[model samples]
Target: AEIAGEYLKKGSQVYVEGRIRTRKYQDKDGNERYSTEIIGDRMQMLGARAGSGEPREPAAAKGEAKPAPAKKPAGKFDDLEDDIPF
Candidate 1:
């Protein structure tokens, strides 16, 4: 399950819904203390870049790096993905 929050403006004028809980405590010097926090459940991306704009191309598909083909010989180490730093 996901909470979809939409139309969140860039600067302000945003709609928000949440709850505030208080913590009752006593200080070391015998003083009363409390704290409040706001928690949210759902949010949505409504900005121009939120939706699907551009598709992602794999590194091997592009000219970035050559992918190891199935026919290629495997390294002596079993952890192949970890062997490459990039």
Candidate 2:
């Protein structure tokens, strides 16, 4: 939720990479319940924030504009090893 609170505006675009997780807990009446959520590992802000009035480009283009440069990953997983299971 930290990313949502910090960067998720009404109309902003974001690219996220993570896994889905589910948690189980008991309710007030002792009933078991489950909740599923996405645990984001990396998040990238795309385009302008809400109300910024900037134009967004198509994710894929045939021959118009060049691709944007890659950005460095944020601090969270900068030092993580690249032996990801996937």
The number of the candidate with the highest TM-score is 2
Q: For candidate 1, report its TM-score.
A: 0.35
Candidate 2 lDDT by residue in tens digits, 1-86: 77689867777777777999999999999999999998888666778646777855435434657768879746667678899999
lDDT of 1 by residue, 9-80 (tens): 356232345677889899999999998877765333332334556443322323456755789666776655
Residue pairs with backbone atoms closer than 3 Å in model 1 (clashes) = 5-43, 5-44
Give the 10-residue window scoring lowest on summed lDDT in candidate 1: 54-63
How much does each candidate deviate from the true structure in C-alpha RMSD? 13.7, 15.7
For candidate 1, the per-residue lDDT at 10 reads 50
Please provide the root mean square deviation of candidate 1 (C-alpha atoms, Å).
13.7
Score candidate 2 by TM-score against the native: 0.46
Query: TM-score of every model?
Result: 0.35, 0.46
